[model samples]
Target chain A: MNKTIFLLMIFLSISAFMLVGCEFGKYPLILDSSVTSGAIRVDLNLPLPVQVTQTTSVNISELRNVTGESVDSMKFYNLTLLIDNNTSPNDAGITGTISVNDNALVTLTNVNISEFQTERSIFDKDLAGKGFQYHAGGVLFLLNALKTQSPDILNVTVVAGTNASSLHFDLKVKLYGQIFANTN
Target chain B: MTRKRSILFTIMSVVCLLTVLTLQVRAQNPLEDAIKQLTSENAKGYLQPFVTAFGANMNSGLYHSADISQLGFTLRLDLIAMGTVIGDAEKKYKATNPYDGSEVETATIFGEQGAIVEPIPGVQYQFQNGQVKTSFIPFFLPQLTIGDVFGTQAIIRYVPIPEVNNVPKVTLFGIGARHCVSQYIPAVPVDLSASIFYQSLEVGNLFEAKTFSLGAQVSKSFAILTVYGGLQYESMSMDVNYTYTGNIPGITVPDANVSLNLDGKNQFRGTAGVDISLALLHIFADINIGSATVISGGVGFGF
Candidate 1:
């Protein structure tokens, strides 16, 4: 009986160590979108509810090489969206949704662009006189979609409010998680 | 008996001399010596491996529940795996040339120079402050311990030069002594022992660390099972040295040599574990709590 109990404890301890190590070994990786000085102008005069979707692909092959695991096999944790708007007139707002390989993963609603512009200008003196906005939001639900599907391309769709016309904006995304790497 | 005593003394003396020699060489410019060989951006990642290795090495042999005399002689091999959460520690430093003191337009942010507009260049750029944040995943460390040589034990943990790996080399050696105080008391049901250990770990040319720990433990035997708990106080000192060779254009880079001495002193560690020994076969597992939570287990044989 004593031997059996000891064996059981050893098994439990090994299991706990494996689980905890896996949890803590994860590192944060930032997948940022290509930013250019040129603005992405969207004309909202065509329809009442105008949606402009910009698609960007992230190559996880390098990440796979570093981690020694396929991108699909890795676990992703926090997903954040970065929205940069460099335009004039504070009457517009944007609703952003992120999709992986056509499947919608995260949707952020009612992001006030004018308020974002005012808040950002507090730190950035360059944007103080110029009407520019910066907004960020956390998208935790993206993890489930990423696990269920193998996504190679990320699609960012920005829906402009009715007052949005000739608005210029940029979008970026970041994820934090761990991958299985070959330590040998 | 005299031969055994002489062998032990010789081993102890050599280890002490090596420790003293290492301290003497690194006492003045420890951090500078550690990082002096690091020149490229990629070499900066080598620092994380040493930190991870040290943490794993320190987490070994927490139980010490076995009385070597009762077991005749014992040898144990422990596989310790651990991960440490590295806080925001500055991993890089950069400075400009003071010879010309010529203010040049740069795209990166530098200290004190917030933002400037260059009328001639027709662009605005900030000085770059070269700082990198480094963190690593969990790794495994294998350790060996042999006990029952006149109430003393010898410990050695070594990882040979790895191929295509982040860490190049790791060597650790230590000695421990345990005294059973319960031998004098006939009515005592538990075996009590006090132990002191000293170890030194050297990771390639990056850094060297020496640790000294003192602990006391008590365990009660119940047939094939033994449960033990102990409190330990450990003091560790490390020397780090690095040099940077990469230079920014138009900025005269000075001789980049850095030396640092880090001390983790008077760390109180607590450990609790169970040992299951059936005849010559024994399996042990323990959890050590200190700056980091470490879980370790092993299987070994004794006569």
Candidate 2:
């Protein structure tokens, strides 16, 4: 009787110990989201062919609604520029610049207006010397603002080179990146 | 008195050690975070290793000895703890970037943080976070065995683990019966038995799994120690349900309900183990080799 009682007590103790404060392992958290700067209309509707620049303000506050939560840090991977040509006759030539918060990050030169749709990575050779780090920093700076639920507006200035045929097109910037947080 | 005191001390030491070891692991709410932001396609790769390893662990530790008493009343209970080793290949899988349909190699649930891949210059994709950063999957459950009438025994197992991190409670239940095969063969030197078992586990509405095993075992007793070996065919499957909260550019629907049915890689296993009986106390350990390697051990008290 004594042995049985002792064994029962031992089992109960082990069960209680196993029940309380058993922890599961924690893993890193990675969240991904895509943000886009809607089409920035660049209408070179001038009497004489001349260079034109258009500035649009874009804020990624909508990312909060997309990710459904705040994140600690973010890094952008792909940046694609989709050019929707609205004019009948395509432009002779086209070039442009992309900036974050007025800080130039990308510069396009001698771009094929006929094939204007191209994707540029942040580390693209074309964006090497053009304040690449600053562009990344500025974008992330705005993105991380979602952490505080207060996103800052990013300025995108597009410089269209001299074009003929009254070049009318819309330039849209699409960005894909990952958000990092430790929700463990 | 001295022998009894020594046994009591040993049992207490084991209990304390297990308690301390189990307490070292801390609970975090990674299950929800691991799959919540992932599309069904990506979630499958991230969680496949867990499914396989978990099933392997569940299918192990079925028996420690093949000896069955002949027409007698005997009862036993065991606290079986099992772990299935995760292979290097299982730690990672090929994941597809939902935006571009490009394949990338990323971490599984048992791996390190996922890989960030740039299929092209601008489109960077990162897979979901790995849930458990370990080399093996582990499980702990209690089993009860009662026998014998006409050289047959029945086994049952049930365990309910309390919820942590807002995840639902995890429950496991199993039933099996073993029949002595050597009883019909007169003067058999070794005890032989054939057994079949079925088990199911559930974790709230998020996960559900089932395991089936059929096998034959043989054993020989030496005083208080019994050596045993078995060959078993086992299978397991898990179903996972989660909401697709990821922002894949082409997915037109939001909050799409995603369900995955996954199977374990292990189909057969060979096991070897020894059981030591001291009065009414029993201790056993075993290792099983199959598609995955699994180790199990437990302590029990019975007559």
Candidate 3:
């Protein structure tokens, strides 16, 4: 009986430790290693960048009758837009435009991935953060931009602080038409 | 005056009980009821159902006492997926479809995962968009449960879950301040340990007795013959309408009355079984006639 018991014990012990002794289930879980999420400490403070492009998809010709006057929005739909790049290159590219009569407005939306990765990184690290909203010039522009034959959506971007980095967030938009008369 | 005397005597007792009952019921962020059966409590037998029933009754009853809209509604969305395991293996079981990774696995919440804990079969649901759903009776607390989840039903008290050998079972349920202990105790490092618990109870009726239970379990796991024992505190209180003989001036005949009870506990139990893991599935099923009388099988899971 003693010899048989010994053999049984030996067999069971060998099986229990077959692999490098890792418990498959029922044991408290412990991570074997750790993982980090963002970039190491880094900073860049420079003049922000700006760009403007005509989105042919946003048609303004459909707003012919809403202005209460014989006016056209399609005519001013592609005016030369002027903008301010006040953000650091490491962050967003802030830009906006004015009307042909210098009465048009320039809007600046929050900067997103396109704004932050303005330049490729030598050391890759995620820069997305809870977006900053200083109101800046965009909101003011939308409410007051005068009549124009051309209207455009200037892609806005920003770095953190007045000129911060690791700034990434996007804007969601739907185009709506309203009456506007532009005089050169 | 005599009738008034009895009412004054039991009011505090009843209030105390109701208070304790309320605290215990909401203490745990308990999961879906279906997961309860897979637990293994050594001797917490024959009173699990009463505990749950009392819990259900009290939970709904308390809501009844509070502000509940006469008309309410529910919008339910359900999802299920059939998944497989991937990981390293010991000897082999069934060579699964794409069987390369580590085989660390556990039972799925619904029938979408694993064996013994497999789905009831053939049940499917429709793909629904975010649809506006409205109804009267905004909610039915009962439907919020799987009617006897985890086999924490009337039968668990008398039935013996199978599949394991000789290892004692430990079942548990804690209410109010004690629930943290349930999660804490099992997590305590021990050589070998297992515990299970269930409760379904009904209590505080104007007529029939209100029933409730407090159960506990403890066990030590070993290579062979793991055994255990348990204790349950249970009770039922009912308001009995008895005739009150009036003897005061200007009063005539007898009137029906309402009575309540305080103080209840009628339970203690235990059991043991062998440890078995199949295809990385931790289950305790009856090796013989397949299924047992009531909840004879159980499975363990990792969060």
Winner by lDDT = 2
Error of 2 at B5 (Å): 13
Tens digits of per-residue lDDT, candidate 3, A1-184, equal 4533433343233222222222122211110111111121223333343232222122333434333233432211111111123233444443332221222323334533243323211111222233322222333333233234334333222122233332223222222222222221
CAPRI-style class, candidate 1: incorrect
Identify the candidate with maximal TM-score: 2
DockQ of each: 0.01, 0.23, 0.00
Please rank every candidate by lDDT, starting with the best.
2, 1, 3
**Candidate 3 regions off by >4 Å?**
A1-184, B1-216, B222-228, B231-254, B260-267, B270-303
The per-candidate count of clashes, in order, stands at 20, 7, 82
lDDT string, candidate 2, B1-303, tens digits = 367775875576456544433342233234665576777777778777777777888888878788887798869777777777777888888887654566888887777767776544433566775666566566677788999988889999886666655545667889999989998886989999999999999876778999999999999999999999999999999998877666655444544788888888889999999999888788788999998899887777676
lDDT of each: 0.45, 0.70, 0.24
- How would you encode candidate 1's per-residue C-alpha lDDT over A16-51 as one tens digit per residue? 443442221122221111111122344444344466
Give the candidates in order of TM-score, highest first.
2, 1, 3
**Model 1 alpha-carbon drift over 4 Å, by segment:** A1-184, B1-53, B56-59, B82-139, B162-167, B245-255
**Highest DockQ scorer:** 2
Residue A51: error of model 1 in Å? Answer: 58
The CA lDDT at B209 in model 3 is 39
In model 3, what lDDT does residue A34 have? 10
Give the lDDT of residue A90 in candidate 1.
68
Better of 2 and 3 by TM-score: 2
